[model samples]
Target: MKITVLIENTKGELEDLINEHGLSLYIEKGNKRILFDTGKTNNFIVNAQKLGINLENIDVVVLSHGHADHGGGLLSFLKINNRAKIYMKRKVFGDYYSGNILFKKSIGINKEVFEKYSSRIEYIDNFTEIMEDVFIITDIQRNHKVPEGNKYLFVKEGTKIVNDKFEHELIMVIKENKGICMFSGCSHNGAVNMIEAVNKLFPGTSIKALIGGFHLAKIPAIDIFSTSQDEIDLIINKIVNEKIEKVYTGHCTGEKAYNKLKQGLGNKIEYIRTGSEVQI
Candidate 1:
């Protein structure tokens, strides 16, 4: 199988273009072509053109979550590949935010974009199979002891907190000739949690590689006892415990957290830049 990071939060090469906070990847194996996430802007399509990736040829499109960084480009992609079936949870269309700033400014899926492609949408609340080897992990409730990050995540019915589990965010699992490759976008449910779920689903199948946003961007709090690095140290510890072979992470996985994880995971980890390809 082949994986290409068409768009990510940062640009590694000087010539690589940087789109605003998004992660889009191209995965191809055999006759199947999969577009993991669409990113926050139409730039994913533009950059994909530069990489010679024909959006029109995609057989399946997976939205990792509702975040703009991940799913905002759906409308543009749909225009190119209107025939492609989209796999995403229904709650992805619900409102999302990032504390003080609305998620549109931070990251969110605009209703107009989704409505435009409503005809091709496939809402998956539980595990959904695209092909015999490709799977989408849904019904992912946070099962670990990790902090839910903050109190910001919620469904607001006109500014009132409504009970919502944010069950929409999903992880993509690909079982190829090499092994299982996990593609995730902003794992607010916890990166370790996502990996563990994959292991449980495919018992004894080693994770060939893991890619996309892990969402470890915890900035410092006012006069907090520890720096954001401390929090990240714990997160890295969890990833290390998983024994994943290779990781290509960026976007919401913040530079600070990436650096911390790099120090711990060393060469086992790598940054997934805007335009790079990894073969598995």
Candidate 2:
């Protein structure tokens, strides 16, 4: 199987492709083509065109989460692949907000998209199999202390804004020829949590690699997660201890966290920017 980064947080060698604060990946194996998590803008469509990828031909489209940076481009994507079934958790359409009232922003998918394309969406609230080897692991269990670093995010409930439970978050786990490859969008559920969840789903199947955001990187100036160093340290230790061979991370995984992972995991930490490809 091979994964092509359609859109991420940066522009790569393909200079024409626009960069946005989001994530989108095109995964292909055998006859199957999967478009995972469209980025926050139509940049993915433009970028995909430049990369020689046909958005209309995707076999399956999966929304890893409801965050704007993750699922904001759904309507544009649906235009190209209108008939394809989009896999997502049921709560993706709920209202989401970030930051305080002074600068809060709506971050969830546009619910009206569901009204227009209801038949094309498959809402999974539990573990599900999209095909023979492709699986969607949903409702990530927080068995460990490593919460998905999204404390600043909130969900609207009546007149109140409560902490986002992230119930809508899910991941794509593909069983490759050699082993398992997990794609947890943004990994707000945390890398270790997502990996462990996949491992549990496929018992004894060693996870060879994982791609997508780790959410470990923080904006120090905002103090949103200034003390994430210890969390990154422990997460790195867990990654090494779990024997995950390689990791391609970006999006919300700020540069500080990437460097930290590089310093600790060395070559195991790979980059996932726009136009990059990973084959396994």
Candidate 3:
């Protein structure tokens, strides 16, 4: 399997591509080419063009969750590839907040965009299959230790608090003879929780690797409320318990948290900069 990062939060000094706080991973396994998320904006298109990625060749499009950073590039993606089937949660759109700022978000294909490619978009309310080897885990029901995720997150029906459990956040499992390669957007459902869910769904399967945002950057600050080193240790320990061999994390994963994870995971973690590629 080939996983190429089309957009990320950082880039190498020699790379001229502009940096953005978003995530977009392009996966190619066998005959399938899948686009995980669209990054924060049209910069994804610019970066893809720079990398010579033919977006039109993508066979499937999957939205990890309903945050703008992950789902924002859909309009541009749809413009290029109108035939790819889309897999997303049922209640995709929602209103969210990054601290004080409000963000209008959507998970699945945008309603307006979907109208144009309704036939190709496949909305997954529960679990669904894209191919014989690729399966999407859509049933997300996990709680977090901190009240950080989806606090201001909700759906809109003319004006209502649509409880969004982040069901739109699906885990993509690519079957390999060794195990499964897990691809996630933000894992708003908690990275460890998502892994546990995946393990339960597919018994005895081990995660070969994890790629995408873990959203650990939003871990509450100690100054405002109260946090302890032990809590951080606990979180890190849980991640280690998953037995994930490697991790490529960035996007909303703040520098402080990333550093902590780096310290904990050490050699097992590889920082994913924009335009980077990993083969497994």
lDDT of 1 at 33: 91
Arranged by lDDT, best first: 2, 1, 3
Tens-place lDDT per residue, model 1, 1-280, is 8888878766757375655567888888899999998887899898888778888999998998777778878888877776789898888887776553344223457788666667788888777777888999885546764334433455655866543355668889988675788988877777767777888888888787888766665421111122256556665676677667788888777776677788888998888778877888
Q: Better model by lDDT, 2 or 3?
A: 2
Ranking by TM-score: 2, 1, 3
Query: For each candidate, what TM-score against the reference?
Result: 0.87, 0.94, 0.86
Model 2 C-alpha lDDT per residue in residues 1-94, reported as the tens digit of each score: 8899988877678777788788999988999989999988888899888888888888889998888778888888888776678999988888
> RMSD for each model, in Å, please?
3.5, 2.0, 3.6
Q: Which residue ranges in model 3 land beyond 4 Å of their true spot?
A: 94-110, 143-149, 152-154, 162-164, 219-231
Query: Candidate 3 at 154: error in angstroms?
Result: 4.2
* Structural RMSD, model 1: 3.5
**What is the lDDT for 196 in model 1?**
79
Most accurate candidate by TM-score: 2
Error of 2 at 215 (Å): 1.0
Q: In candidate 2, which residue pairs get closer than 3 Å at backbone N, Cα or C atoms, i.e. clash? A: 148-188
